[model samples]
Target: MKIRIMIVDDQALMRDGLSSILQLKEELEVVATASNGQDAFEKAREFTPDIILMDIRMPGSSGVEGTRLIHRANLPVKVLMLTTFKDTELILEALEEGASGYLLKDMATDTIVQAIKTVYSGGVVLPEDLTAQLFLDKRKTPHSDLEPVGQPVDRSLLTDREWGVLSELGKGLNNREIAEALYITEGTVKNHVSNIISKLEVRDRTQAAIYAVRHGISTTYDF
Candidate 1:
């Protein structure tokens, strides 16, 4: 099945341009286009596309808020942020709000199209050149009491199940993917993720994922 897609951007030219370019791919279909984030959400609820290409900044209801809306509403669509700006804080905020990926507007057209397919297949995407910057700027060091990296983390602090979830989260799989990987209920995965965050004392799942990477705790499960 072709991946259903929605293009959301403040600029009409950008939205239309992306829609035109993406429609050429036999594997993709541009189902809808919205001028801003709020409009995107409304259309998302109505059209329910498999993926959304969201722009970070907009006049009313930015992409971050739009992502949060879709996430909190439990929509089935994955959001991939597209923007010209390279702000690390916005990247973290978008991911924290449940964005599946972030892409620069300057990237090759094929790269953006592949990113949509990647997110549609339950994978996560982030700009490579900026990930290091994100880690250095937005990724916080774990709390003082948290176990130091390379040390064996106490199982008591985080159970084996929670560890599994953490590892999957580190790989940037959403809850559904993690549940499928671990053979657990999504509800159970959510519970484990909550516990992972509380036990790790990180600000959010984004930070928790970063911690998982920094600690070399990651899943070997094939994507």
Candidate 2:
């Protein structure tokens, strides 16, 4: 089945270029396009595409507002933020507004396609550069109160083994990768992931990973 996609950007060139590239994949389909968040919201309600490629900055309305609206409306559409700006505040807002992933505009077309597919399959896609930036920010000014917009989890509660699991998650490792890295079985990794999610009070591995980063629970050695 071809994955339905909606492209939202203020620039015609960007929307067109993304559409053209996405059309090359046999498993992808462009269902709709919008110039701003308001238009995107209207079209999204009408078309109900599986995914939306949203630009952070727009004229009429911002992608963050649109994502919040969509999320509040309980739509099934997953949002993948595609933008040039990497402002940490905006990125966090998008995630809090229910974006499935974030990718920069400078990423290769092939990488964007893969990111879409990954987000479609219920995975998170954060740029490696952004991860590095978060780590650097933590080192420069360690905010003890930094937490994702939700009930914060106490990192002190996590067992040492669970910390290892979450560190791998911060690195964006899947169960297999985590198992190999930690010299554990995949089943063990899965169990640890589940426990981590429960302890963190997050919905999925993606949210847990975000929490790990925000709480400084992720170790530099893991990366």
Candidate 3:
């Protein structure tokens, strides 16, 4: 089955260009296009695409707000942010709003295609050169002493297999990569991921990864 997608960009040329390139891929289908965040949100409900490539800045209902609304609505769609800025605060805001990944506007065409596929297949995507900076900036920022809103996490609740899966998630490894590392099938990895999400009580792998990293599991999971 082809992956269904929506392209949301304020620039007509950008939207058309991306749509044109994506249409050439046999495994992908551009089901919809929106000029702004509000339009994107509405079209998302109408088309119900598997993925949305969203611009960070828009005239009305910016991408961050749209992403939050989509997440709050509990849609099954995954959002991948498209932006020209590497601004740490902006990226973190999108992530906090439940964006699955962020990609630069100038990224190579092949990389952009693969990023959509990667996020669609349940992996977190960030520009390779910018990931370290993002993490470091986030860590340096002071967080409030108040606990985050969620069930108190107890790593003890995870099984040995789930621990392995959680560790890989923290490292941003997709199902296929996790399968190869653990000598399991991709189907098994998917099952493990679902089980881990349930156990962790998180919205998605991005949240799961943040939880794992906070508990120090990510330190050893790195490549």
Candidate 4:
């Protein structure tokens, strides 16, 4: 099946360029285009695209806020943030708000398309450098206060295997990659991820990762 896509950017030229590039692929379709976050939100509900290419900075509501709104709606529309700024805060905020992927505006068209597909396939895509930076920053923060003293984690809701899966997830590996590293099936990895999310009381993987880091459940180099 063709993957439905929506482009949301203030620049008409950027939107047109992206739309044209995506339209070239046989399995991708551009369902709608929006000028800003608000318009994106409206079109999202109307078109119900499988993926949304969002620009971080917009005239009205920023893409971060828009991502948060769309995520809260639970619309199955994965968000891929495309922007010029590589501001760590913005990137982390978008991820925390439930962005499935992130790419620089200057990325090659092919990479953008691949990112969309990856996210649609229930995976995450982060720029290599950005991923490295995240790990380095996470490592620098001391976890002395966050470590659980008595027990590793409650296994009532999570089995030992599930906690192991969550620990890997805390290291920023997506489902497929996590499965590969753990020598398990993707379906099993996903189930464990879901259980971990519910047990941790987190909204998304990003938040769960943060929780794991803060609680010392996972180490930076574990992944």
Candidate 4 runs further than 4 Å off:
132-177, 198-201, 209-223
Clashes in model 3: which pairs? none
Residue-wise C-alpha lDDT for candidate 2, range 90-179, written one tens digit per residue: 776788788877888898988988888877865677655575565455345556345332224554767878989887786666788789
Candidate 1 local Cα displacement, residue 159, angstroms: 9.5
Candidate 1 lDDT by residue in tens digits, 1-223? 9899999999999999889999999999999999887898999999999999999989889999899899889999899998755465676678778887788889999999878877786566754335544554444544424333333555577877788888888776878989989899989988888888899897667667766654556633221
Q: Against the hidden reference, what TM-scores do the models get?
A: 0.70, 0.78, 0.79, 0.76
- Model 3 lDDT per residue over 54-123, tens place: 9998887888888988888988899999986556676768888899878888988899889888898878
Q: Candidate 1 — what's its lDDT?
A: 0.78
Q: How accurate locally, in lDDT, is each candidate?
A: 0.78, 0.79, 0.81, 0.76
Q: What is the lDDT, from 0 to 100, of the residue 74 in candidate 1?
A: 90
Tell me the deviation in Å of residue 65 in model 3.
1.2
- On TM-score, the stronger of 1 and 2 is 2
Ranking by lDDT: 3, 2, 1, 4
After superposition, candidate 3 runs with Cα above 4 Å error: 139-163, 185-201, 211-219
Clashes of 1: 0
Error of 4 at 114 (Å): 1.5
Q: Which candidate leads in lDDT?
A: 3
